[model samples]
Target: MSFYTSLNGLKNAQTDLGVISNNIANAETNGFKKSTVAFSDIIAGSAFTNPKLMLGIGATVEAINQNFAQGPVEQTGAALDLVVNGDGFFTTRSAISGDTLYTRNGAFEVDDNGYILRGGNRLQAFPTDAAGVVSGNTLQSVQVPPTNASGAQFAGVAVGKNGVITASYADGTNVAVGKIALATFLSPGGLRQEGSANWSATGLSGTATYGEPDSGFYGGILSGALERSNVDLSEEMVGLITAQRNFQANAKAIDTATQISQTIINLRT
Candidate 1:
């Protein structure tokens, strides 16, 4: 029984090490959030057992909780690089799965087709009129308007702090293309990580509440910048050391238990 308990401890220590290693590995990944391991102790006795005599079997992993604290923002000077200054995530549509995903990674670029893209996914936004008024609640891909038929050449595009997108023409005319949409959840930490800094809403997170940036509880967009990974190397290093020590202690316990069993077997012989 003691041997099994020590083995469980070893397994838990190994799990902790793996989680810490992953956090350390993604320290430089943009918009990466760190995760912490939760644990629960197991008792071998039932409720009828004496309270003071109940034996602790081992520890079990409860859940891995995500840390959603804001990461540091870095200025990249790239037009499409963006960061949320408060709370909220940029909504996007996955190209392969066609599922709606949310991400904090604001690194985006306009494709030759004039569609704003994050990787292969299309950034989602609300349509706007020429005067920048939001047209409706419907969400659509953010796109740059093509050159006007009157011969005005497509010049460039700009995004406002409020997430409004505007396209400019060589004729000095500007048209409101769309307003980028941001999504907030009741429990941000409950969102599921979909890798590549993207997340999907889960029942624990509740349905997404969409809104424009810089309005209501949504965060304002910071163009030409990006949010860095929230992993702290020093903190992770300390956790790594602690987990290693735990692993070693459990290994020792197992060895001691084996020696005691061997001695008893020799006595019986």
Candidate 2:
């Protein structure tokens, strides 16, 4: 039992170290969130003449939850780059699986075909009327029309505070393409991580509700900027140190258990 107990502690410490290491590694990743390791204890105790004599068996990992706190806003100055100034996620769809994904990585660009993409996912948006008002609940792909025969290119793209995407042509023509849509969840922290800095909705997170930025519960958009990773280097370093000490202590306990077992064998001899 002592050996098993110490072994579980060793495993727990290793898991903690892994989580901390990952946070440290992704400190520079855009829109990345950190996760913390959780644990629960098991008991070997049974109802006996003296219940106080019972012992705890070992510890086991309970969950690894992500910290969804907003990351620092960084000024990138790129026309396509964006950051959420308030509280929502940029909606995207995976080209491969066609699954709807949510992300905070607003670094986007229009492809050759004029379709906006991020991480190979088509950026989703809502159609806006000539008055720049969102017209319907239907989500459409954000598009920037190609240059015409006169070679009048899309000179610039602007995402307003309210999430309207307007493409300005070189000929001084402004066209309202599509409005970037933001999605809010009942519990943002409950979103399940889908790789590439994306997240998937879960039962805990509930279905995402889409709306224009700064309207209703969705967050406003900040153009020419991006959100940095929320991981804190100093905190992760401290956690690394703590997990190391725990591992060492568990190793010591295992060694002591071995020594005690040897002593008992010697006495029998």
Candidate 3:
């Protein structure tokens, strides 16, 4: 029984170490959020046993929760590099899966077809009228339309703080292409991580609530900037040290228990 309890402690310590190591590894990953391990004790007792005499068998992992605290924002001087100044995630559609994903990583680039992309995923936004007003709740892929026969060349693209995307032409004509859509959740920690700093809404997170940036509680977009990873190296290092000590202590306890068992066997012999 002692050995099993010690073994459980060892396993839990290893799990903590792995989580801390992952956080340290992704410290430089943009838009990365760190995770913390939670443990719950396993109480062993029969219904007839005295409540005060219940034995704690061991601990089990209860959860691994993500920390969604805001990370630092850095200026990248790239027009497509964006950061949410408050709260919200940029919505995107995966080309391969066709599943809607959300992310804080605003690093984006335009393809030859004039579609704004993050990897194979296309950025999603609300369609806008000629006056730049949001038209409806439906989301469309953000893109720069091809130059027309009128000879107006594609000049530049701009993303406003309010999440509006505008395309400029050499002919000095500007068009409101779309309003970038932001999604907020009732429980952000319940979101499922899809890697590449992307996340998908889960039943636990509830359905996404779409809104324009800089309006209401939605965060404003910061163009030419990006959000850094939220991992703190110093904090992770301390946690690593603590987990290592716990592992060592549990291992020693197991060794001591084995020695006691061997001595008892010798006495019986």
Tell me how many residue pairs clash in candidate 1. Answer: 0
- Pairs with steric clashes in candidate 3: none
lDDT per residue (tens digit) for residues 99-120 in model 1: 9989999999988888898988
Writing each residue's lDDT as its tens digit, candidate 2 over 28-110 gives 99999999998999976446636777678889999899888899999989878999887889999877899999999989998
| TM-score per model over all chains | 0.96, 0.94, 0.97
Per residue, candidate 3 scores C-alpha lDDT tens digits across 223-247 of 9999999999999999999999999
Error of 3 at 214 (Å): 0.6
Clashing pairs in 2: none
* TM-score-better candidate, 2 vs 3: 3
Q: Which regions of candidate 3 are displaced past 4 Å?
A: 148-150
Candidate 1, position 42, lDDT: 96
Task: Tell me the lDDT of candidate 2.
Answer: 0.88
lDDT of 3 at 73: 91
Q: RMSD of model 3, in Å? A: 1.2
On lDDT, the stronger of 1 and 2 is 1
By TM-score, the better pick of 1 and 2 is 1
